[model samples]
Target: MEKTLVLIKPDAFEAHHVGDIIKMYEGIGLRIAAMKLLQMDERLASIHYAEHIGRPYYEPLVSFMTSGPIVAMVLMGEDAIHRVRELHGKTNPAEAADGTIRKLYATDGRKNAVHASDSPESANREIHIFFNETEIYD
Candidate 1:
């Protein structure tokens, strides 16, 4: 099975949508291989969003992410990365397709309800950012 990282962001958690979000993934056949509730720090945010470091949205992104607790999870299934991204929908709620997670819960581009790694390489990198090897269950 392929493994990918998914983050149910602070907005979703604060709004008490964790169960609903997890249900969405479960309903689609993905298994939760690892999970945690974490309060991110600036250093970790910078590491995770390193590619966006110099961009205009970087600082605010970090600030918002660190503003509250988030749920980090590893989802495993065939084509896990693509499946989760499909469920997550667009980065902007306004453009996300109907019935998608972001379309249903997000308020703006940055406040989009979920995050998923875009590729196998990124998934591996992102998963490690939030979890150690022993934390994952196959």
Candidate 2:
């Protein structure tokens, strides 16, 4: 089984859509390997999004992420990385498909509901950012 990291962004958390998002994943047979609700500090957000550090959206992205508590989780299942990203849809909710999580709950590009690891390598790295050995279940 593949394991991927997912982040229920602050906007979605503030809007109370965590259940809906999690259900969508579980509904598809993805297992929640690890989960937690916590506020992200600037340092961690920086580390999580390090690749996008100099991009135009980086500043506001960090600010929004650190603004409130977020739901961080590790989802495990076949093709979990790709599946979760597909479920999350486009970065901009406006461009997301009709049945996607972003389409249903996202407010805008900045607040586009969720984040998922883009690849297997990224999945392993991202999962470690928020979860430890004891935090995840087989």
Candidate 3:
């Protein structure tokens, strides 16, 4: 089965939508293999967003992510990475589809309510960054 990393960002947590979001994923048949709620430190934020390090919105984006507790999870299923992204909708809420998570909860690009790994390699890396070997189950 394919595995993917999913982050229910601080915005969603603050809005009390974590359960709703998890339910949505479960409704779609994706298994929640592992999960945790934690506040991200600056160092972890930097590592998680390493690729966007030098971008204009990088610092603010990191700050937003670290602002509150977030739900980090590993979802397993066929094409999990792609499936989760589709469920999340586009990166920008303004452009997201009507029924997508982002469209329903996100206010903008920077405040987009969730994050999902875009590829298998990223999924592996992100899943490791947040979860240990025993956290994930088949």
Best by lDDT: 1
Please write out the lDDT profile of model 2 over residues 82-129, one tens digit for every residue.
Answer: 899899889998899999999999989888889999999999899998
Over 1-138, each residue of candidate 1 has an lDDT whose tens digit, in order, gives 999999999999999999999999999999999999999999999999999999998999999999899999999999999999999899999999998999988989999989999999999999999999999999
Query: In the order shown, what is each candidate's alpha-carbon RMSD?
Result: 0.6, 0.8, 0.8
In model 2, how large is the Cα lDDT of residue 38?
97
Error of 3 at 117 (Å): 0.3
Q: Which 10 consecutive positions of candidate 3 have the poorest summed lDDT?
A: 57-66
lDDT of each: 0.94, 0.93, 0.93
Which candidate, 1 or 2, would have the higher lDDT against the true structure? 1
C-alpha RMSD of candidate 1: 0.6
* Clashes by residue pair, model 3: none
Maximum-TM-score candidate = 1
Backbone clashes, candidate 3 = 0
What TM-score does model 3 achieve against the real structure?
0.97
